[model samples]
Target chain A: METELSKRLGIEHAIFGFTPFPAVAAAISRAGGLGVLGAVRYTAPGDLARDLDWMQEHTGGRPYGLDVVMPAGKVEGVTEADVEAMIPEGHRRFVEELLTKHGVPPLPAGEASGWRITGWMEHVARSQLDVAFDYPIKLLANALGSPPADVVGRAHDRGVLVAALAGSAVHARRHAEAGIDIVVAQGYEAGGHTGEIASMVLTPEVVDAVGPLPVLAAGGIGSGEQIAAGLALGAQGVWLGSVWLTTTEADLHSRALTAKLLAAGSGDTVRSRALTGKPARQLRTEWTDAWDDPDGPGTLPMPLQGLLVAEAVSRIQKHGTEPLLGTPVGQIVGRMNSERSVRQVFDELTRGFERAVDRVQRIAGRSAS
Target chain B: METELSKRLGIEHAIFGFTPFPAVAAAISRAGGLGVLGAVRYTAPGDLARDLDWMQEHTGGRPYGLDVVMPAGKVEGVTEADVEAMIPEGHRRFVEELLTKHGVPPLPAGEASGWRITGWMEHVARSQLDVAFDYPIKLLANALGSPPADVVGRAHDRGVLVAALAGSAVHARRHAEAGIDIVVAQGYEAGGHTGEIASMVLTPEVVDAVGPLPVLAAGGIGSGEQIAAGLALGAQGVWLGSVWLTTTEADLHSRALTAKLLAAGSGDTVRSRALTGKPARQLRTEWTDAWDDPDGPGTLPMPLQGLLVAEAVSRIQKHGTEPLLGTPVGQIVGRMNSERSVRQVFDELTRGFERAVDRVQRIAGRSAS
Candidate 1:
């Protein structure tokens, strides 16, 4: 399961496990794969520093990475107040009405839990990066697009590799031009923001577009067989996100949402713009349906959309509204039917990859490897 | 590449090349793969009879298949006129206005083209099947759903294997329960009518749902590596549609449409109900865009929608209106950039499959076979 990229990164497998939970990230790193901690949830720099410190201790000197949602250009000067003021009254009224219709109560006073738009601000991301550089991070990945040139240079200066997620060949070429070390070719079936291309088409296209640069296949990849297919499609490894959500090491903070995810089928997920301004694949809930209703107001742009729904989402989680409880998950959620330790999942993936290799070899008229 | 299904079918490779042209179908069979000709375009039973006779002579005794669009229940008593009478006047005017706006003129008198809704009617499908049984067709496949139990029985009685396209595990289970010999796991990125699940997720799910019964992986499979990936995902064979659209053996009739497909990228295709009452993937054109417009009258259900647009589509092709000309295709159109003989394409697929197998074997810590 190892590739040149894995060898360079000092990891044992080609699996890149992405999680917002530092515990899951540390566990993945300790289990012989690169674990990348997502920084979008850490609004305050000190919170990210605390998690990294914890990860540093728990990972047992194993390599781990950090993921930041940095827009291609500078995202400075736009304050949270400015983003809030941009939301229309009609949009606000629609959200309020939607909550009322669903009988969802407001969040308790002084209990803040939903997303903070300021986390997406450039200053906040830079502060998180500053704290990240203080630690021994092996890789830095951008969620939205290629990071700024200066950021890439700074990461390289610290001997850290830069990676970016691309949903199409065009975007992959752009990342290659930006000197990103690895391209995560995330497809439409991926959680969070994704483009129209599926991994079957996008992986080969990206690999062809940037031959020398390694590509990690992502989206709808849960099993070890999918990892083999990714490598078959010329990807150096597989980048998985949703599969980790059900792992014992993950702390989703809501048991109700976890139950819903376990019971969902592949068709249960929908790609909607309700989560952020961009189209993102998530569990289809009454909340997403309401946003898609023809008569209802459409979703607002990013930062603004997140701002408007942050409280409503918190309330939905607080109340455990069965129909509205959901989290961003890929179509692979259909197979994440039970909870398992990160080590267990990792072993199964390796076994599946081996079986797939033997299967393909036999099919090609050769004896099973 | 051989599988149990391919071995039983007496084909050299586990590739199911689906095309609407008899020439392409014959060439695929001669190239050591199963060629399944789409029977929906044959309005006259005699025409299908003639093509089957031609296929018999050209295939050199190699195995081929026939695909019919038969609904689960009987579709008796539905004439083309009856279906036309049910279309709303608003919808008719919308199509007329769209054509006029695009400067697409009406079809020349008596030069009837486009689709015939009657071809989808039960009587027509049965007639086509009756003519098909006279030939040495090795497989009988239904495009929409599992053929009625009697039809499956009839195919089995004739020593023909029956296969049905299923978009989900539930649908695959139904097909298996109906005693269909094979299930084609068609995914969201497939040409023509497709469900929401992409091949990466759908293939494994369908395979898991129905084991011992062979599954053919379809959608976004245009290369040997994808075929290898499909086999890795547990499918016995790969079913392809869009990849053959540009093959030298295919006769698209309209050079404009063929040129459009060759020049298009994977992202250029869209899944819209604008073609039929059901969502079908096709090359996105101004015609599709006009139907998708927010202000336009929404698409009608299947038969009526096909009836309303048939003449307009004929007109668009008749006039060679560049912006309005398109055809059913998959996201794999991105790679169908050149025209080649069916044998050439088959050779490339085999080579690519071998490369993928060797690559996976190497990655799995075994020396390349």
Candidate 2:
């Protein structure tokens, strides 16, 4: 199950479990795959630092990574008030109408807006990176695009690997040019923000384009057979995200967990811009559908869309309406119909990977003989 | 390059080139891979018979297959006149306006509509199947869904292997249950009509779901490396369509040839329903964009949409305008930037497969030693 990339990263296998839950990350690391904690939701650097501190205590001295969302071309200088003002009145009315239609009750006056990323900006991501460097972080990944050259340099200076998730070979080249240690070629079949290319086509292109730089295939990969496919596509490793969502270690809303487990199919998710002002793959629900209505105002760009929908998401979450509730996920959610421990997932991935390798080797050996 | 599936099929490599071009199909068969001629464009059984006869003459006795598009659930009992009456006046106006804006000349009165697919009906496909069975066809493949049970039975009775292209594991299971000999799991990244899942994830799932039935990976696969990836994902073979488009043997129109070579990229295609009444991946063009416009009437379902757009397509092709010109293709068009003979393309595929296997072997050997 081990790969050259895994040996280099000092892990038992080249499996990366990226999740917002610290417990899941720690559990995955304990299970021998490098677990990466998604730090974008932690608005404050102190919160991320504390979460990492908690994660480190449970990881049994194994290495883990931090994932920050800093899209290379985010709009700057727009204050929250300014961005809020940019959302049209018609969009607000549409959202209110959609909530009524879906039977989602309004939120209380003083309830929190729930977990949302404010680290989409470069400066905010830089603050998170500073906190990450203070810990024993072995890797720092940029989820949306290539990290700035200085960020890559800073991580390299401290012996931490700089990884970037690219939706295309063009983006992968940008990462390699900017001194990224690893390129995660995230295909359209992946959850959240993804490019149009599929992992089967994109992984080898990224590997060839980067020329010796390690490539980690991502998107539509939740099984060991897929991991072997990634390796065959010239990827040195694989970076997985949504597969961790239904694990026992994950912190999920009851409605979301139930929805994912019972209702989600390979075609259940859609690449919609409603959630984050970007085309992110998520569970297709009435909430996403209403936002995409032709008669309603179209979605705003990234930060504005996220900002506009924060309260609506909060209300939806509070009401626990199945039609209004959703989660970011890939088509792989079809295979994630049951809950398993993080360690159990790791075992399956490794065992399945070994079996796939044996199959390939048997074929190769027969040919050679 | 040989796979157990290929050996069973009596081929040198586990490669299947599915193309509408007879020369390309025959050339692929002559070059050691099985060639499957797409018969969706064959408006009549006689047309398919004539084409298959030509292919047989060129194939030098090598086994070849026939591909017919018969999606599982198309509306029946609606005549061409009945469906033509269903198209809205606004959609008709919009198509006319788009063509007029592009300066496309009107078609001469009573020239046959450039595209016709009355054969999408079960009876029509059955007629084509009878014609196919009369020939030396080694296989009969349904491009869109599980073939009718009787169609599968008829193929089996005639000593022809039954195959079906599935976009999902659920579809693949249906094919296996219907007695399909092979399941081609086509990913979203593939050209033409594709399902939402990526091949990296879908191949293994389809292979597992189909049990002993052979699985051929399709979508976003143009190179030998991708072919290796398909096998690694548990597919017994790889099925390709768009890669053959740019080959010298392809029967592409001049504008289409230019569009594919000069403009199509991995990201330049969109899954638009403007063509064939289904979400088919095609080279993104102003024609597709106009049809997807929110202001315009949304596309009608299958045969209706195809019929509605036929005249518009005729004018566009006649005009040869770059913005309106398009072709069904996969994201693999990024790699099909040059014109090679079918033999050259086949050589590259097998050579690349060997290189990828050697790379995998070296890594596996290193770990073992």
Best by lDDT: 1
Residues A1-369 of candidate 1: C-alpha lDDT, one tens digit per residue: 878899999999999999999999998999899999999989888999999989989999999999998887865577778778989999999988888888998778888866676677778888999999999999999998899999999999999999999999999999999989999999988888899998889999999899989999999899998888889999999999999999998987789888998899999999998988789999999999989888889898887898888888878888988888888899999999999999999999989999998888888889895
**Candidate 1 TM-score to native:** 0.98
CAPRI-style grade of the A/B interface in model 1: high
Can you write out model 2's per-residue Cα lDDT over A198-264, one digit (the tens) per residue?
8887898888899699999899899887887788788888899999988888877665656555558
Query: Clashing pairs in model 1?
Result: B277-B302
- On residues B252-353, what C-alpha lDDT tens digit does candidate 1 reach at each position? 778888899989998999998898889999999988887888888889998788888887877887788999899999999999999999999999999999
Query: Which ten residues in a row are the worst by lDDT in model 2 chain A?
Result: A360-369
What are the Cα lDDT values of the candidates?
A: 0.91, 0.82
Query: DockQ of each candidate's interface versus the true one?
Result: 0.85, 0.58
Give candidate 1's iRMS in Å, 1 decimal: 0.7
TM values, all candidates:
0.98, 0.92
lDDT of 1 at B22: 95
